[model samples]
Each structure stands twice: as C-alpha cells, then as structure tokens.
Target: MTTRSCLLPPSIIRPGGRPLLSTGRAAARAALIALSGLLWVGALATPPPSSLRGADAACVNCHRRSGLGSIEGHIAIPPIAGPYLFVPRGERLAELGIPFVDTARINHDPYTDESLARAIRGGIGANGKTLNYLMPRYQIDDATMAELIGYLKGLRVSPSPGVSTSVLHFATIITPDADPVKRRGMLAVMNQYFVDKNNAVARTKAPTLYSSHTTMFRVERRWQLHVWELTGAPATWEAQLRKHLAAEPVFAVISGLGGSHWGPVQRFCEEQSLPCLFPNVEAPTGHDSDFYSVYFSRGVLLEAQLIARELADAAEPANRVVQVFRAGDVGVQAARDLQAARAHSGQQIVNRVLPAHATSKDLGAALRDVDAADALVLWLRPGDLSALEKVSPPTSRVWISGEMGGLEQAPLPASWRAAARMAYPVDLPGRRVVRVDYALSWFRIRKIPLLAQQVQADTYLACGLVSETLNHMVDAFVREYLIERVEMALDHRALTGYYPRLTLAPGQRFASKGGYIVRFSDPQGPRIAALGDWITP
Candidate 1:
C-alpha cells in the first residue's frame, strides 16, 4: 500500500492567541510525549492482514452504520454493493471536474471509474451534480480509490424499463356546486352514451327539451352546437304533459291532464276544444269500446302492430312465437293478431300477461316462468322497457317491442346501451321527410328562420311512433281544422322521407299501418329495420 500524508496547514490550525512554535509548547509538549510511547508499542505489534482491508469498508462505515453521520430525517444511505460501485462503470472521473458531478453525462452513457470518483468527491458524475444536499465528499487516497473502482467493475449492469410518454385528459363534467366526484361520474356516463371512440366531441349540449333548467346551464358549455333548455318541472306528470305538448303541438287535453295542477292547461284547452288537439285520456281501462274521447286510436295501434310484424319477419326467426302482452284490451288485441298468425301457419301459440306497472324484476321472473319461447312481443313504456332490460337474462331472445323508440338522453348508462333496443314508426328529424316537415313546421308556426338553417346543418333520423303519430295528427288538423284543405289530394303519396303518409281521412290517424324493430349489432351499431302495414287476418 502507498503511504499518504494527512496534515492541516499552519493557516488552517490556530490555537487561542498562540504564536507558531518551532519548539514544543505546553499542550504540544504533553501530546507529543504521550504519542511517542504509543508509537513505540504499535511498532512492536503486527499490522492487520492486507487481504482484510477491503476498499468498500470506508463507504460501509458511514452508509451501513446506524447513527454515524447519517443525513437528518432521511433513512440510512444505501450500500454501493453489487455492480454499481461509488463510481459506476464506463464513466471518466476527470470529465466530472472538481466540484460538480456530471449526473446528466453519466446518465447519458454508461458508468465508469472516473465518473464514480466524480460522483463521490465532486458531488456529480458525467451528468454534473447529484441530487440531495447532504451527500458528503469522500476523503481517500488514490490506491484505495483504484481498489474501489476495480471491485465495482466486477458487478453486472441492468437497464431499467422505459417510461410512458402519453398523457390522460381525464374527461369530466362540472355541476353546480355538486361534489366533484359525482360530477365526474355523471360525465363518465354521458361520455359512454354520447361520445364515440375517437372522442371527437368533448361535450354536447342536450336539447333543453330534455334537461332541467339547472342542468341545461351547467351543460351548455360542453355542448358543441345546439342549446335547447327545458322549461318545466322534471319527472312530474305536469312536466311530462308539457314536454309532450312542446314536442307534439297537436296533443289534445285528454282528461286526467288535471288533478296534478294541470287544471290551468286543461281548462285552457277545453275552452278552445274545437281548435286544440285533445287526447282521450279516460277511455275504459280494459274495454274495447271505440271511445274517441281521450285515447289514441286503434288505427295507431294497428299501424304499430303492422310495423312490428314486418320487422319481426325481417329479423327471420326459425320458430313462430307468441305475443307477451299486458293484461288489458290492447294486449288482447295484440295477442289476437299473433293468434291469427299462428292459426294461419298452423304453429303452436301462447301468451304471457302482466300488470301495467310491472317491475323489471317482475318481468324477468315472469319471462323465466314462461314455457320455452322464441321471442317476446313487448308492449310497454320506455321506463318499463329499461327496467325489463335490467332484470332480464341475457339470452338469444329477440324482442319486438311496442313503439318505444331509441335512446334520446345524454350520459346514457352502459347497461342501457347493452340492453335497450327497439323501434319507432316515425322518421327521425335528421332524415329527409322528417327534416323537411320539421323545417316547414317551424317556419309556419314559430316563423323562426334560424330553425330551418339548423335543421339543414344538424338533424337526426330517428323518431318515436307517438311523435310520428302526433305529427300526422297535426298535419291533418292543419289541413282540415285550420286550412280546410279537406279535398284529398288525388295521386298524393306518402312523403318521400317521412315514415307515415301525409294524407288523412275522417278519423284515420296515420299511414304506414306498421312500426319498425331495432336491434343491437356490434358491426352496424343500433339498426332499425322497417315493418310493413297491419292487415286483418
């Protein structure tokens, strides 16, 4: 081993007001005399074996010791064991210079002895400067340093895994003082329903016709285009009526529109009964009477059935299935038609009946108890349909639902997307005939020029049967009640784009005496295939 001197310069060592002494001072004299006796004893003793003098002993002394000069608040420093020594391989200690270790330089390339020295003394490696303020410089002779480097050189080097470069958007919605987490949940549902895979549109303002005033304002910023606000209460009967009226102007005030503070609108309609469209709301619950007072006509139901049948045919099932209907006259009528089809084909027939307000669990249980069947002829409200989907088992069961139409709300739940599939008789607004009618009607009624432009730019091609029926009624009321264009325009045909015909007879509700069937298909997404008109068996 090479010997080295460890000394303090005269300027660095100063005793209290004492002059430099060539001869012994009182303190120096005492210390020198003591040291001389110790030196004499140490010269007689044998030195420790060189093989036990490992270079790593110096680093372990501080890093491995429990309390020896450890940085405050930090845990014990890690040992420089394995392949990585104080100085890594392939780095040049000289390049790190004096005070700064080139950390970046070392990171850019491989480690080396020179780099390790820089990291240990200069506080930086090839990259210049290591992290942390507490790491002290190591004081060692050249021979020890070389021995340390040689030991580190024998260690193996392994690369770390690559880090990711992409960033997430964390799509979210903002509700009025609502909990941030709940708002995010709402946004996630909306994204699942409205936003497609590409995420081209971040937010869409739902038509006010659908949203509450508060929700409308909150969502307006997210909407890319249209901003329609709903003006009435939510989920209440009155609100339902108002929404129906706004969407379908010809809706008449059938009885029962009252009893729930609907007295005002009902009274106003009754006063103008001759001009206002009034729906018959009080027809006997289970009777087949042609009560035209407050109900939709059989003609509408017949048309819906025709459409359902046609769609079923298009679907092309192997077995003839019975209709599952509600326990009422309308259900009976639907069941009668299925019976007729069965009679004609000489196939077995059956029927399942349930109460009007059956829950999804109830429906699912009822379906399970039924004899094995090919399809379900569903006739229920949208809410009922949603519930049924929730509880019903996922089988290869095809459903020909009553005219419940498509998904219209934003932030649709994934469960809803997977379960609900049905059709409507009316052409949705974005399509050709419906578009023309929407534009023309808005121009005629509201005299709003912008609506026509809006229709031209963004329109949807899906309409509910009830909506379509309402449109037909409105057209008839306009031609007969308002314009008095009573003479049937001979040679006039169904509008090219509208699903139902424009013409009307005394009580004839609509044309295309049929409905459509919708199904979920991965490749085509949601598809609607048209059913033909209904006919007497």
Candidate 2:
C-alpha cells in the first residue's frame, strides 16, 4: 500500500508556545503531555478526512484495478471482492462455486456491514484481530462509508466473455494492407498451435484443480481461435472490428498482423478494454498510458532511434542528415521520429520523400542532392533498395532501416552495402539460432510451411506466452487480470525468439526496448557484424 508522510511537532512546547523545562517534575509532566498529543496526532493523521473518493482510490493501488489483490514480495494482499469478503463461515469456497484465488483468505469469519466498516476505519478484522499494518485505517462518514461498501460489493468476479466451460475463445486480426505471405504464414502457425494444444489434452476433461486440499477447479477448456481479417479503408477498420467482435466475441486479440496504419485496431482494442498482445506492426500507436495493445517492439520507430543515437555519438557528426523514403510508407513516421530525436542536436535534418510509386529515376533524383559530408538514411523497401544501383553512394556516412529492408537479406546494391550501417533492432542471426530453431523444428515436424520465418516465430511465441499466462491465472479469466499477468510473466521468459530479452511493467507497452547497430561484414551476401553492443535509446 502507498504510504504518505505527516508533519509532527519537532519539540515539546507548552500550550502557550514556550519550550518545556528538561529537568525534574516539569520534564515528567511535559513528557506525559507530549505522549497524549502524539496519540491525538496519530488519530487525526492516520485516517486523514472523509473524502470518500480519495479513500476508495487507495483501494485500487492496494487491491489492484480488478479488486483481486496481488502478492508483493512475501506479503499476500488478500482479495477484497464482495464474494471473498462476505462468504459465510464454514462454507467452502468451491461449494459456493467461487473460483480459487491464490491470495484468498479461506475459512475466515465472514465480514458484516458493521465489521467491514470497522475493518476499514479501525484496522480491525471481523474476528476482532488487528489487520495488517499495510492496510491503512480510513476515516469516512457513515454515508460515504456505505457508498464505498456498496462499491466493493458491486465488484463481481464473474468469468469474462468468450470463456466457456470447455472453451477459451481468442481472435487474431489482420489488416487488408498486411503482407499476404506473412499473413498466410502467421495463420498457419496459429492453426497448428491450436491443434497441438487441444491434441495434448484430448482425453483430459478433468477439472483444473489449482490447489491440492480444496475441491476448487474449473473444467479444462479447449483453445479456439478466430481470424478477423479487415478489408476496406483504415477509417472503417474499427467499425468492422466491432461488428466482428459483436458476431464472435473473444476474450482477447492475439498475434495480429498490420501494415502502415494499425492505429484503428489499436484504438479499438483500448476502447473495448480488450487485450491486443504482441501484434506485428511497424508503426505502433499509443503512449505509455494505454492499457491494452502491447507490442514486441516499437518496430521502425525503434530503428530511427538507433540511427539517431549513432549520429549523436559520431566522432564527427554529420553537418546535415538526409532521410529518403517513399510517400505514404511507414518510413515517413520513422523519419519524423528520427528528426524529433535530433531536434536539440543543432544538426540539420533534411527529408526527401519520393512518390508512392516512385521509379528508379525518381529514386535516383531523391538521392542526387545529398552532399558527401551529409549522413544519408534510406528508409526504403527491398525493391527501392535494388533500384539504388542506378545512383552512386552520395555519402560514406550512411545508415539503412534493417526492418524495412528485410534485415540481413535486404537487397541493397554492393556499393551502398559497403558504405551503409544497419539499424538492427533484433537479435543477430548467430545469437538467436537456437531459440529460433525451436520454432523452426516444430514447424518442420508439423509440416507447416515456413513462408515468413520472423512473423511465424513471433506468432508462435505470442501463443505460447498467452497460454503460459492463462495457466498461471488458474480459473480467473478477467481481462484486466490477463494484462496484469502478462506484465508480471514477461520478465521470466527464457526463449524470447528474436529479441534478446522481453520485459514490461505497468506503463510499458513495448516488451523489447533495445537493438544493435550493425554494418555489412562483406560487400556480398547477407553477412553483418555489430558496430557496437545493444543500444536502448
């Protein structure tokens, strides 16, 4: 629980504002008076005032937004939900059909309206025992206390939508502009994963007993996946998603694919309070305050930062940095992010945006004005990279988007490869082979075609993570709790696929926070060497 500081008198002064004598009987009387004053101060200070909303706000910090208490270190903050608090004595929680919560205080005396109020205001339990020291004693009026009690009673621990007795329904969203090959590969992995999951538990219909002593459990549920493919303008994607959700409600959206604009889908998830986990998006939307919509990385925006960091630390920073990208591509945002990162650096940032359907001639023209002293950044796709053969290397100080140009397999011309460094935002090929091969080996055994290796591996990883988190949650299927569990579980993941490590906390939406800056080891083939260690900018 959150603690606040209080101001107490620094010295024992007389009521007439004079310092008391330090010796003999006067000192004794003053000590007694100070002790009485301290008791009064504690009463007034402990439970500040009757601001009901403020007091209740503290409940969320301690008990969590779900009203399902969490364990901090060795301390078990028990659930304060109405069912857990008011369940009658001698009544088995499983008999009442209440799901097993790890933090539940079982077999305790039930709290009445009066006792519960006493517990809140006086830090005394219904059993006439003192509550945990961490539990603050709030002082509120009768009406306000009643309203708060009513609010806590209203908190239900009912199962969320798409959670049936024998099925846990989930969805995967795909935008119209997403790559067809990657989409096919992602769906292939997702389908095979679901089949393997159910096959492993085909004959196991036993209740999911989370405890050894109690008869508390829920029927094991088969996993179900729904593919929600959006077709139309980005503006209409949200409405389409809502319609699909209305037709086929899901507990969460997982491992979705997107293109330049994943904003509508991200916004829809946040608005619906739905968990959108680890979507494959280049330019992800939303700030730290966003509750739903977690991603593996920031994608190209992350690459931009890597490049900006390189420029900032350069022995002789470029006089002017030039960024070239096609119009309406996700690179536009990447370029803007780079510019913003270097806003206070005093160096010039020049943008050269080509036509959306730019030809080799137009691409050459976009690079023609670059000076030898200026740093060049190419935020182009493979096709545009191949077209760069028509133009000479305008600057020796050059950086390219490893993400947009397809990582190590980017089709950069030999001349540009010799001069350019790559903003490598994923684990290097050699470092991640073993972890990545785990997925590859599974695909080989399942005979699932490896069309898009990265996307498929990430999708497989997402499915495994969600499955693991659900297992940890036991029978609690609350959406908010799902997000909370993900935040807690990510740091413990060992096989994080392409990323070196994945981590998230309350406000962190991006799991992988850093990447490497690399350069081509040779003029030919897809061989690269890191210029330095991983950078988190």
Candidate 3:
C-alpha cells in the first residue's frame, strides 16, 4: 500500500462516531511537539507525539541521522525509512531498492498508513507485538502524524553529493600559514593512502548471493583526494574553503593541515555540514553543539589545563607566575587559560607578550622581571628558544610548551635546560620510539624529508584513522553514519600513534585525553625526566 494509505486523516473517524480532529488542532499539536513535549490530556484519544523532545530523545536520536538506525547495547533500533516500512509481505527488501541494514525486521507484515500510525501512536509493532521500551508512545493528531511520517520518509532518501557507484571523492585542506614541511608530508600520506585503497582489489565483484535488501557483494570503489590549499589571510580562509568544496564536491575531508588559526576551517565545516575528520592544528576550534568537525586533541588549550594541574600539585606554590608568548601566536589563548586557572590560587599572574618577529633583545626584555621566586612559562618557537641564550637566568622553576618549542629538541641554551619543565602532550620519546620509527620508515621509503616529525606523525595517524573507520562502514556510505562509526570505533583502536589512548563519545570530539609534565634530564641532549604522571584536564 502507498504512504497515503498509511496516514489516517481526520476525514476517516472511527466507526463508534468519534469526532474528526480539526486541521488547526493537528497543526497546534505539531507546533507543541516542536516547542514543548507535554500533551493536552483533555483532548482526544490520540497518544503523545512520537517524540517527547523534553523527556525521551527524538526518534532521530536513536534511529540516527540516517533512518538506517543504530545498535545500542544489543538493542537494535530498526530502520524507519519509507522503503523499509512499506515493503510488501512475502517480498524481499532486495526486491525494492532498499539497502540492507542488520536492524531491518524480516518475517513481518508490511505496514500501511493505518498500521504505521498505530506503531507511532501506540507501542505496537506491525506484527502486533508490543514494542520495546525504547519506543515512545506518542499521542499525535492525524495531520501531525502524517507530517512526521512524511519527514521520516524524506530523512535520507537522497544520496549525498560526490558519491558515485564506483568512487568516493574526498578533500583535504591546507592553510597558507601551515608549515610547508608538514603540508607536504600530509599530502604525501593522503595520496599514498588513496592509491593503496584503489589498488586493494583487482576488479569489482558481482552479487554472488542475496538476502533481503540490495546487493550482497563488494564494489571496488576508487578513493579520490583533492588538496585545497588556501592563500591570503585567516579571515579569507573560509571563503576559499567554500569555493574549493563547491568546485570539488567531495564526500568528506580526510586529513588536513592548519596553522595557528583553525577556527575558520572548523566554522566552515560545521556550517557546510561536512565531515572534517581530523586536522593537524595546535589550537582547534571547539563547540559541543557542532557534529561535523572532529579533532585528535584540544591542542595547546589542553596543555594549559595540564600545567594548571601540575601547579596545583606543587609542593610549594610560587609567589608569582609569568607567561611569555608572541603577540599573534596561538599561545595568547594558552596564556589566558593559565591566568584563569590561577585566578583563585592567590598567585600573582603576569603576561609578557613579545611583538611578533621580535629580536633577541625583546625576548630578554620580557624575562627581565621574572624573579627567583617566580615560575616562568615560555610559549615560544625554536627561534625564541635560541634567543634565550642572550638572557641570564631569572628563575629556576620554568615551564615550556613541548608542542611549540619542538618537544625534547627545543633549542634551549645549556644554562636554561635544567630550569625548563615541558608540558608533553603525547607519549614520551622513549615510549613512542617504536611507533614513531614506523612512520619514519615509511617516510624514508617514500623519500620524504623529516622536517616536521610530530606534524607528519599526526597527519599519518589521521589518515590511518579515516581508513580504519571506512573499513568498519563496509558499504554503508552515509556522511552521518561515517561520523557515528568513527565515534564508536575510536575506543577500540589499539595503535593510536602518538597518543597512549584515544577516546570519544556522542558529545565528545577531542579524542586524545592527557599529557605529561617533564624536564630535561641534564644540561644537554634529548633525555628528559617526567616530573609527574599523565594528566587529563
């Protein structure tokens, strides 16, 4: 039967002479479900809206953005898409164009408009069994019921752009401010990954067997990658990204490279509803409400928290805490975060921002006020670290950002090496050598230089993550499903490269959880000593 038959409009009241629902009343019911979840009990026998937006989550919350549904602790929420609902009895789901999902019910009678309404309004299934507790019993008016049913049918009926029968296209972005070395390394890995994906199978296989829905065989789909290199200022990066997306029309963004500013790219991805998997950016844009963009970590923002925790655990608190960073760098935020964390700690906080591209004299000037009783924090690059040789010792207890100062290889003068305690976000050089060597071997084989080791490693990790998540997807290629699968699969990952452990949930986006606080073991060399254990803040 058609969807028209599934709907029970006001014109068709019960045989017991029940009054027909007014169109205005139905419209009001829909508006109420959207605004509030409560139902007026004094009205008709219609149950509450199928979704109690205030109490129980909406149908989409469980069924997923793709009406294909999702599995939660072995309780399967079956697909409510039109084809899955209206399939005729004795006919296979494959007989129609419906794609196969494990949750779709078999050996059940097809639902008409009337039966679908019964399933939505009452906790009853098409086969007359009581629905699971997960199913909400809604009391929606006839017009609103039809509208809701219609909305479900249209949820994911159309295929997303850039999806073809034999190919899936993706894009990677690079900002002008991105490190040139890291950009090259990232693109190299991405290109190689696509090449390996396309060459995995010799030929496309035919449908050797069939069950209920769609083809039951694999299709050799080639992966295409587009590198979108943005120029000009950070403010114009979003426009450039939009233009690239329009021209390329990619299915998703794989692994990208970014500089101090990733907010514009993050905003573009959220606004465009694009799945930007992961990018190598020290400071990432964050929003719990956004679903499209995901990150490996919170970048330097996470480091600030770790430093605060370390300070809290200190044996003796410093009289004053001073942070020195370049004006236009991402360190500005990290400094602010440090200041906020020390707001109630009774410590005097000082910020010394050196002008961008400042000379060695300026670096010394910023540290001149740092006294013996003060704890100094440096958020500078190698150039500034090398410049530190020009300044005399101001404090014995000092902190540095491992990310910005090149981890263990920061160009610190021998005089300052014993004083600087680094906030290392990833695994230690000793513990991660085996993992780092694996990527280094790949680079050597590919004849790629090792200019930016951490960036390249992170980019490689991102590409691998995307590849693994796609494998889990099998043939389910919906954009929303891609993101959902990533979130679920992240926890099971064993080889997380730099991070000791990576995790994410429905509301969590940053995957890597914590870092270590360490100091140089001696006056020279790359050896370091962990001041404390891994901290997640």
Judging by lDDT against the true structure, name the best candidate: 2
lDDT string for model 1 (1-537, tens) is 211112322211211112223223333321221112111122222122211122222332333211111222344343332322334445543333211111112234444677767665556744564634344444444644554454333222221011011111111112122223333332332233223321423444345563432332222111111111223432343344444444443312211111112233333332322122222111112122111222222332453355345434545542545455566424555556556644655445557677766666666766674333344455554455555545443434445443322223212224444433444444443454454565345334533333212211112111122223322222112111221111122114334233433433323332233344444433233333332322321
Candidate 2 lDDT tens digits, 137-204 = 76556754665575566556777788888888999999999989999999999999999889876877
lDDT by residue (268-310, candidate 3, tens digit) is 8876768898788888877655677888888788888888887
Q: Give the whole-model CA lDDT for all candidates, comma-separated.
A: 0.33, 0.81, 0.75
Residue 33 accuracy (lDDT) in model 2: 24
Instruction: Return the top candidate by TM-score.
Output: 2
Q: TM-score each candidate.
A: 0.33, 0.87, 0.86
Better of 2 and 3 by lDDT: 2
- Candidate 3 structure lDDT: 0.75
How much does candidate 1 score in TM-score?
0.33
Model with the higher TM-score, candidate 1 or 3: 3
Q: Which 10-residue window of candidate 2 scores lowest in summed lDDT?
A: 10-19
Worst 10 residues of 1 by lDDT: 159-168
User: Which candidate would rank higher by TM-score, 2 or 3?
Assistant: 2
> Which pairs clash (backbone N, Cα, C closer than 3 Å) in model 2?
none
